[model samples]
Target: MRLAIIGGLAAGPAAAAEAKRRAPDAEVVLFEQGPHISVGTCEIPYLLGGHLEPETTLQVLTPEAMERTRGVTVHVRHRVTALDPRRSRLTVEALDYGSTREEAFDRFILATGARARRLGVEGEDAAGVFTVRDLVDTHAIQRWLDTQPVRHVVIVGGGYIGLEMAEAMRSRGLRASILDPNGRVLGSTVACEASDLMDRAVAEAGVPVRAERATEILAEDDGRVRAVRTDRGELIGCQMVIVSVGVEPRTELAAAAGLRLGDMGGVAVDDQMHTSARSVWACGDVVQIPRAPDGRRVLWPLATMARRTARVAARNAAGSASTRSADRFRPFAGAVGVRAFGVEVGSVGLSLSRALDAGFDAVATDVRHVSRTRAFPEAAPIDVRLVSERGSGRILGGQLVGREGAALRANVLVPLVIGGGTVRDLAEDFDLIYNPPLGPAVDPLKVAASQAMRDAG
Candidate 1:
């Protein structure tokens, strides 16, 4: 059996290794358009902030190492220009030599990941504008900082990356400001109270956020960025601009090959991670996952979903012939959108707005509780908002924001929400321990869940 994989980032490489494990004798190959593969994309910000050295662990595995250890062929700087699902073949371009070649496969997997979104405004191609999504992007931002006198940086989005880059720039003694048209960070995915907590968090970090649209990028005579022009006809001065708005799935190859795509703009995959096309599947940020509580397909560009879906796609493709597990139809497990920040914030399943959009009569119950008891010195507060369905009393989702346990609380919410647990289930059935200077007598998660049960009643 011949297996061909497009993309060499987190998902693609993982699928290749998993395939090799499942079918040892099968010929497995992975292609990455960039010079590097198996990158630790989440570490890019620390590299920018000088917290990490690029020469260190930023790149997880090299092409040579992957080929040597995983028993799979790895190709870097190879671009898949076209894919023909009917023939089970693809056209690959050697970027270095500018030569094209055809490869045939019995099974194929696409982990094309995502691309940085552009503002579509003029002067975007100037010298000092950047998007720090990959190793190459981090290196480019480093090069800009080294070559140019960048004392002031304007981040164009207030999402996770934008907020991280803001702290990263400030840590480097650069004045960083956020320009978000949505007037808030994290968008509408977070509950209203959580958004308020995020606002306070960024302000305390000394990052000024401007709630306005950036209409254009102004550059100097030498084609270097100078300022950003807003829709209100105001110019926000800056020497550099980071475009961290967000990312969309890179599904051009799949779409051109007549593969189905979900309304969420990701390649539509079934429970087995199989695309509509025969003998082909897609994972990573390119594919959609079934959101819990309502099974609505959502394109969440999260590493956890990418890896889980990759395993399903790989095991199904490589071990399809085996009747070892009759119902080997594996779907992605539960997933929640989580971001690490000074004031960490995360949401699982659905927000109140998303519940309403999904045609559920839902209400969000907010609770503020202490991280520790009063006896503990300077116990911090945790903000949790639980979203519950009205009549059914099902636990739809939750948003948590705090400096201490926001991310951990989010992890606790995932299993319960995915298990179809109800408000009462979260409130009483869940085991939450308590200790002074560790956690309060009644955990914030339970407090919020109990509040949600009351609101439902």
Candidate 2:
């Protein structure tokens, strides 16, 4: 089998490695436009915090290492400019030499991740202005920091990435502040209470919050950032600026090749990660995923989705395309949005608003529980909120917020949410762990679930 994988960060390399393992004799080639493949993107903020070295995180696996250990050929500094799915061929550009080549494959996977969203405001392209989406962005920020006299950093958005950069800035003894367009800067995926908790956490870190949008970035004469003017007519002065507004899928190459895109603006793919084109499957941030049960499209641009979908796509691509079997087609298990931010938050499935948008008779119930039993002096409070269908009591979604156990609680909800477990099942069916240092006798998740059941009744 001759398999080609386009992209590298998380999905591309994952599919390539899996394809090589699934078909040992397969000619697997992975192409990455960036200099590094399998880069540690989540650690970019920490790299700014001076907690990690660039080489340690920037390059998770070198092209040489991918060829040596994984038995796969890697092409870094190369971009896939065009794809001819009809011919099962792709046009690749050697970035270093400005040369082009044609590559033929039996099957291909598009793991082309996401790109940083721009503010669309003036002076956004100035020096010392950046977005922390990839290793290249981080390196650019580092280079600017080495030359610029930075004391304060103004973050344009108050999302998870903004919160992380706030911590990173404070760690480096630099002042940081966030400017969000609304009070619920954390976005709708987080419950109102969870947003409040995160707000408090960011405030505690000495980062100021402003409910405004950046209208213009005021830069110095040398094209370096100096200040940002908001729509509110207020100017936020800072030596550096990091725009953490969010990201959109990089699917132009896929779309130009006649691949279908979902309403969610990502490349559309079936359960087997097959795109509309023959012999071409898509995965990673480039594809829109349907949330479990409700089947509503949710933006799951996280690493988990990339890895999971890539494995499925690779397994399918490894088999003979002509002898396709239904039994051999591995279905993509839906995602329960899992993320760890500055406050250790994990929200699975859907939020209450999302449930209503999905046309569910939903009710959200929340409770305050301790991280540990009362006997433990170090026990901290954990906020648990669960959303369930009002009529059938099916678990819809959940959000956990606290200094500890939030991500752990989210893990427990992952299975329940994915398996379509009900509120009653969470309340009465299984026995959860009971170590005083770990959790309460009845887990906080169950406590919230029980409340949800009662509220549904």
Candidate 3:
């Protein structure tokens, strides 16, 4: 069997390796359009802040290592221009040599992932404007910082990337400001109270965050960005602009090949990661999977989801009998984690608003407590909010915010939500490791769950 995988960032490599492992004699080939493969894109902000070296982001896996260890042919700077499902052939372009070739495969996997969404406003093509997406973009940002006199940066979004880059710019002694069109930071994902807390944390770091949208980008004679014009008619001066609005799935190849797409504009795949086309599979950010909380098919561009879905696709491609079972694939619960300033935040399943929107009679309960025992000198404040169905007390969702132990605590709630455990079940059956220096005797999660149960009652 011969397998051809497109897009070698996160899912493509995983699929290639897994396919090789499951079927040792099968020929596996991974193609990447960039010079590097498997870049840790989440760490780009830290590289910009000087906290991490540029080489660290490229350390996830090298193409040579994949070839040497996994017996997979890794082709960097090779772009798949067209897919011929009927012929089982791909029209690929060798970017470095400017050559074109055709590759035949018994099976194909589409892991093209996503590209950064752009604002179509005027002057967006200015020299100093950037979108944080790939290794090339990070290198370009680093070059700008090294060559140009950039003392201030304007981030045009209030999402996770925008907030993280704001913190990164501040660490590098640059004045960072966030301009979000939405009235609140983090938009509707986070509750109002938690959003306010995050906003205050960013503000305290000397990064001014505005709830105004950018009408236009102002550029100088050299076509370098100078400032941003807001919808409120205010000009915010800056030397650089980082646009982090969001990302859209890169499904041009899939759509052109006539693959069915989901409501979320991603390639539609079944539980086995099988696309509508025969002998082809799709995974990563380009495919929409079932979100567990409400069973809705949504686009979740998380690394965890990407890796899991890719492995499933690989197993099916390799003709694994276990993968043939309908129950082999697990649903994604949309688990996520983020850190800004000194606070770490995490959420799993749904938010309070999402639970209500899903037609559940939900009640959210918030609890505040110290991460450690009060007697412990290093104890820090931790806040937990749990959303539960009113009558059944089922744990629909949860959010955590704190200087420490936030993500760890939120991870505990993920299984509960996936298993459909109730708040009362968490209160009665949950066991958390504890010590004076680590955490309180009664876990904060249990406390929050108990409170949720009461609210449900």
Model 1 lDDT tens row, 130-207: 997898888889898989889899999987778778878987988988898877777743443444777887787778
lDDT of each: 0.83, 0.82, 0.87
TM-score of each: 0.95, 0.94, 0.97
RMSD to truth, every model = 1.9, 2.3, 1.6
Tell me the spans in candidate 1 whose CA falls farther than 4 Å from its real position. 189-192, 322-341
Candidate 2, residue 92: Cα displacement in angstroms equals: 1.4
For lDDT, candidate 1 versus 2, the one ahead is: 1
Show where candidate 2 strays beyond 4 Å. 53-55, 189-195, 321-342
Prediction 3 TM-score vs. true? 0.97
- Model 3 clash pairs? none
Sort by lDDT, best first. 3, 1, 2
> How many clashing pairs does model 2 include?
0
Clashes of each: 0, 0, 0
Backbone-clash count (model 3) = 0
Top TM-score: which candidate number? 3
